[model samples]
Target: MRNLLIFCYFLLFFIGLSCKETKKEDINITTDDIEVSDNLQAVTKKSKSILFFGDSLTAGLGLDIEDAFPAIIQRKIDSLGLSYQVINAGLSGETTAGGKNRIDWVLKQDVDIFVLELGANDGLRGVPLSETRNNLQAIIDFVRQKNPEVKIILTGMQIPPNLGVEYTTEFKKIFPELAAKNKLELIPFLLENVAGIPDLNQADGIHPTKEGHKILAKNTWEVLKDVI
Candidate 1:
């Protein structure tokens, strides 16, 4: 009887050790799972961001979201296996003043590349050249303040002859002037092949159609690809 009792005690001791080992294994598994989750979150947070900030031209007014140039750029980035995420902050009919007012809110997140495409609506509205320049400069300054390392791409815009030659010429010069002053990359013209072409533009003749967006994307990609 003494021998049996001793054997039972030994069995209980071994079982307890087995249970503790199993518990340790479970704890290790849980720790590994948590570590994996943390790694995934870190990767997501570290992905670079490219922000396309602009007006109706960038918004793709009459077309689908996928038809927009920003979306097209996203597709290109994805195809190249690039990790950069594109944020389209375009708003319809947004003037330089509107962009200036709204930029503070828009820049609440990280921005690696800032493609600025404003001042078109200002030109259309016949807003004073000085006011447009001031507002645009303010927006640029705000962006620089938000991210000093951000690569700025200023897109040039031109208005119809209704705005008069002096105003139109001055407006056209704004982008290059700002680009030179700020040492920013210039796209020269955003609507290069799309503007003035009836087939590329929508019925309003201001916004580009889906087919036109492809050309615009090409134009943007030419300069943007080099920077990225």
Candidate 2:
């Protein structure tokens, strides 16, 4: 009887030891999985952002959101396997003053690249050149204040002499002057080849057609590529 009892005790002890070893192996496997998850998370890249802030031109008035120049830029970035998120913060008829007013809200998101395209409406409306300049400067200041490291690209614009040559010329000068003052990148005349071309513009003769937006995207990509 004593021998049988001792044999039973030894069997139970060996069973408990085997169970402990199995539990330890499971814990090791769980730890390895956790470490692998952490490593994968560490290697994953976080996408930077490019924000296009302007009026109807940026907003793609009369067109789908995906057809906008910003969306086109996004496709270009994606094609190259670049990790940049393009945000079109364009509003139809947004002026420099309007941009200045809403820039804070726009800046709520992370913006590594800022493309400013606001003065067209201001110039078209014959808003005072000083007001336009001041508003643009304020908007630039707001962006800088939010993040001094932000890369701002000011898009140049031109208006007809109906606003007077002085106004028109100064309006054209606003972008470069602000660019120089702020040490920002400049896209000279955002509507370079497309502007004044009847085929490129819509019936309104103001906004660019889909093909025209492609040219806009190309013009932007020219300077944008160098920066990014």
Model 2, stretches more than 4 Å misplaced? 1-46
lDDT of 1 by residue, 1-228 (tens): 999999999999999999999898777457888989966764695489899998877888998888999999989998898888888899998989889999989999869999999998888889999999999899899999988999999998888879689989998999899999999999998888888999999898888999999999999999999999
- TM-score for predicted model 2 compared with the true structure: 0.80
Q: What lDDT would each prediction earn against the true structure?
A: 0.89, 0.89
User: So what's the TM-score on candidate 1?
Assistant: 0.81
- Provide the global lDDT of candidate 1 against the true structure: 0.89
Alpha carbon deviation, residue 192, candidate 1 (Å): 0.7
TM per candidate comes to 0.81, 0.80
**Candidate 1 — number of clashing residue pairs?**
0
lDDT of 1 at 140: 90
Per-residue CA lDDT of candidate 2, range 1-228, in tens?
Answer: 999999999999999999999998777457888889865653464368899999999999988999889999989997888877788899998988889889999889658999999989988888888999999999989998998889999998998788678888778888898899889999998999999899999999999999999999999999999888
